[model samples]
Target: MAEVKLFGFWGSPFSSRVQMALKLKGVSYEYIEEDLPNKSPSLLKYNPIHKKIPVLLHKEKPIAESLVILEYIDETWEGYSIMPEDPYERAMVRFWVKFLDEKFLGAAWKACWGEGKEQEKAMEDAQEVLTTLENELKGKKFFGGDNIGLVDIAANFIAFWVGVIQDVVGINLIEEDTFPTLFKWSEEFLSCEVVKGCLPPKDKLSAFLLARKEAITEAAKSIVYK
Candidate 1:
């Protein structure tokens, strides 16, 4: 049996992050597709607390949470460390990763589900997050200096999902003029051979988001009718 196993949802950015890290590190693993709405017994067994996807099982030991799994992967794989050797540089990367996880992710999700005024506010908030990120990227090719690193991986989830949310919500927060650095980073990040090859198809992701939106809207309407 393969020593590594991954349980993930195809359209989940969290899952994508772990998958990308595993691939970049050249680790071979068994991939299991979990039905999130009806999560499999194995997935539940592996991640009892969160019951979430992107669970990485290494040598039969399970690791939950994408960022935590990323660190584990880097430490396990000796070559091509995703984090910097310098203590200060590594701290900077961790700082950005925490910022994106706590702040940007929620704002992006809010932008997706919000309506008229709420959505406008969400967009404004998302733009502010992007603006902050753009400023951080000034004179830097990647979030962790010249090469892609942990912060880049953590932030990439927002970049991918935010684009999908923008299409579904009919609003664009990462415009060229507003967030040029981030906008360019998105293109570059997605263009990497590993990411480009691994990404879920755009049409498929769009359909999934549209269906989710419709379900939410219908549920709201049903509540109003009731």
Candidate 2:
């Protein structure tokens, strides 16, 4: 058996992505929880560039970046393939993954930092992103068609984190009536055994985001005062 280990933070969606993939693939690995504010020496040494969580150690070799780690895991494990086999299909999956990563994923942080008009603008931007995804997922059960695949896993964080941000900022971009497809996907993704088993508790995640939003708001206030 190949030795596998994962370094991650509990509340980080990026880390949760890898954890979900690992569980789905039936790959057993040791999990080390890292404190992001004061990262462990091992995590720092392993991921020198980003010092980020969701680092995968395979046979004692560390691979950083959650997306890269997901690919690595999918390739290394044979039982369940998360990515599609055909080149064209694979490219299509990658396209949506890239879109979500580049556009929607970071908008929550921006919205958290903005105030008044800025906040409203950020929410609009995020809503547009969700609208795009909602349309794309209109007829598909998952991004990879019937079964959940790499794109679905890659974009899963948006489903989970958006709710946390919505709760923190009191903005709901993904209402059932407005973005029904996306909202349904969120429910299905969260209800998946692999995903449901691994997610951080709801209250804990909400508290974490609430604190993060408060800290960002306080920092913005300090800057205005200065």
Candidate 3:
């Protein structure tokens, strides 16, 4: 039997992505929940530079970054494919995953967490990112076409976490009518059994996000007063 261990946080989409991929591949892993503020010693040892969660330890070798872990899971495991077979298709998947992690997620976070003029600018940027994704998702059930793949896994943040954070902040960036295709994609993605099983509870996630929002607001007020 293979020894597989995963260090992750329940509320993080990045962590959930790794979980979803491992589950999709039918790979059983020991899950260790990490406290983000005070990360575990093993997590620090494994992912020293990033010091982030969703680090996969297979046979004692560590792999950091959710996207990188997903690719590793696909290549190492002998079950369902998480990435496409064709080279061009794989390239496209990599492109969209990069876009989601590096571009879209940042804008979405700022839109939910920023204030005043910064919030306004972030909302516009997030909307533009959504529009691009909406167009890409047009006529496709999933970014992987028929099934979940690398891009779909990478997009877990947009499909779920962002929505929860937006609700906590009382903002609506991913409207169904506005981004119909993307909305439909989210629905279809969440409907999958693998995804449903890996997701953190909605009520719990909402509470966590609400607390984070309050903390941000309080910090801002303190900065203003100071």
Clash pairs for candidate 2: none
Q: TM-score of every model?
A: 0.92, 0.91, 0.94
The TM-score, computed over Cα atoms with residue i paired to residue i, of candidate 2 is: 0.91
TM for candidate 1 is 0.92
Q: Of 1 and 3, which scores higher on TM-score?
A: 3
Summarize candidate 1's per-residue lDDT along 31-119 as a digit string, tens digits.
99999999999999999999999999998999999999999999899776788888887788778888887777766666666666655
The runs of at least 3 residues in candidate 3 whose Cα sits more than 4 Å from the true structure, single-residue gaps closed, are: 217-226
Give the lowest summed-lDDT range of ten residues in model 1.
217-226
Go through the candidates in order and give each one's C-alpha lDDT: 0.81, 0.80, 0.86
* Deviating ranges (above 4 Å) for candidate 1: 216-226
| Candidate 3 or 2, higher TM-score | 3
- Stretches off by above 4 angstroms in model 2 are 218-226
Number of clashes in model 2? 0
- Residue-by-residue lDDT tens digits, candidate 2, 79-140: 88899889897788778887878787556556655677756666677788888888888898
Model 2 score (lDDT):
0.80
| Predicted structure with the largest lDDT when compared to the true one | 3
